[model samples]
Target: MDTTRSARIILVPGFWLGAWAWDEVAAILREQGRDVTALTLPGLEPEHPARGEVSLEDHVGAIEAAIGAGEGPVLLVAHSGAAIPATVALDRNIDRIPRTVWVDTAPVVDGSAMDASFEGDEMPLDALWEEELGQGSMRDLTDEQLAQFRRRAVPEPAGAVRDRPSLTDDRRLDVPATIVCTAYSADDYRSYAEQGASFLAGVLEHRALTMIDLPTGHWPMWSKPAELAAIIADEADAAAR
Candidate 1:
């Protein structure tokens, strides 16, 4: 158990993303002297033959491996669909992680999949930012940024989406969570937790919920990298104390 108290951020991308998605945020965090590791989930490899065979447990094991690589208190940052596997990982190793940051997503008890239509085998980048993601989700992306996103976007494995999560330990809820509320305010997130919204019900009663209002679209690292990094750095600082 490498619990040295310093902070490390292991970023987990949401559907149809890879470690490259966190380049900007990772760079910023690096400047602040925080260790950052962005993960590309198993089966997310470009044309991986095992993609169809990947399961929620595989995803969880992948995240767990990333956390084990770090040397201190780790912060697992999960974006959108990645939250499910991250939550499951925490359930098994909550002591190693001090905080979990969810970007535009939270843990759910049922761990249902988002059936975003995959063109052929993978979800198209345009379909995600243009249709699936809310309008203006990519409004902050520059032409170059958009182009780079298209070039780097990898197909998310269908199995991971459809695979059911298995979390038997309730201790996962004891780990503090910080949700970077994009397109929604801290008040809005709290209200959802209060009302027991389907997406937020599982971790509504978490030991502590540190809500930060970013007010961007789903992909804040693309739209507001600096702000997003600052929020993550703040959380890391808090965790260190």
Candidate 2:
């Protein structure tokens, strides 16, 4: 038995998603005897009265709290827009998290907003789909998966996406990051980084950046759960070691 597999895994969902989005992947990780905590961020929960008031910092606080609550080593598995807050939280709690597994998303640099063009106090799932579809982010999802997502999706707080993140600590750049490319190839991601894509700026500056190509859609937790789980497990084990 490998004792290093003891690292706790924290899964953070992207916009319009909750902890439930990681169900399949979490179940598989659990079967492998890994501890997992899937987080439903501040405004992503249903029927929240202050949904519009939740800011990017609120999401960062939530992630920081989750990481602080864990013992030993911790690994973060962040998907899509969740990467914005996750990266800020990572900077605040760098020593606790040994590694981060970014799912089809990279860290958003300091002063960068997750969605600067987003209007209103909240953004609905349909609107997000319209934007993402143009990038082919929904390519591989099945109709059933799409329906299920639409049914469970919640409106993302505009502040969480529109507000910029602040990072005071530069040590976070030293932390290892594993980018699981789902909607695009690893080479494509590198090219974007090389081309100085603003969204990938932080990742480009990361000291230990590794990319894994797992071609699918943006929601690999539904489109390729097993493969995603395996990759996460591998990273968790590595982090534990």
Candidate 3:
């Protein structure tokens, strides 16, 4: 690994969010001279006409295209639901991705969808917030932050949330991974992996795995942007090495 070589960092936002969600963190990374690209996965754009038709594969292809356009290997940073397609995209483009940082999420196993119970053409942000407000994932967010989030949030396409990710290459297991623990402790996540948690079935299988303790809500990029950027930069440096 060449520690001096800088790799492009691709940031993938979670459900109901676009690349704009990463503005703060991306700005900090840029200040440190790191290349970063924040993505607005299919269907998450405001008033996208064909949003309802966007599938999981569409998100995967978007990630793949980003990696393909970059030079050398890239570092992927996936938040929440974005982890699903990002994991599949990383599997498909294994050679181009040297590492991935899963923020408050884990790389799901093959054939597993982000939410099997999700129904309808889209999941509105209002409905999601109503259900998730009391959840730990929403902790630490201020009233203003929550209000802004709701104002900017878009409806997530059902197919993107419901479709199962296809990971054919076992070599994806060889890629390095870092799990930034938020809304849960690192120990708790390790225990989940030990107990074979369905969503984290692929976590313990990674050849090189690192656990980071970033105690906050699920949206660390908003609540802890500077800390998140530091972690991402450290991992990006590690990936280069």
> Which predicted model would earn the best lDDT?
2
Q: List the residue pairs that clash in candidate 3.
A: none
Measured over all alpha carbons after superposition, the RMSD of each candidate to the real structure, in angstroms, is 3.4, 1.5, 1.9
Q: Estimate, for each residue in 59-119, the C-alpha lDDT of model 1 and write its tens digit.
A: 8999999888857788788998898888888888878887778998886565455543332
Candidate number with the higher TM-score (1 or 3): 3
For model 3, the superposed segments whose C-alpha errors exceed 4 Å read 1-4
- The candidate with the higher lDDT, 2 or 3, is 2
- Alpha carbon lDDT of residue 223, candidate 3? 95
Worst 10 residues of 2 by lDDT: 1-10
* Per-residue lDDT of 61 in model 2: 89
List TM-score per model, in order: 0.86, 0.95, 0.95
- lDDT per residue for candidate 3 within 1-241, as digits (tens), equals 3434767899999999999999999999998888899999888889799776899989989998888886877999999889899999988888788888999998888898878788789988898676788776888888998989999999999988889887889888878899999988989998998997878877777777788999999899999999999999888987776
- lDDT-sorted candidate list, best first: 2, 3, 1
Ranked by TM-score, top first: 2, 3, 1
135 Cα displacement, candidate 1 (Å): 3.0
Which candidate, 1 or 3, would have the higher lDDT against the true structure? 3
Error of 3 at 236 (Å): 1.0
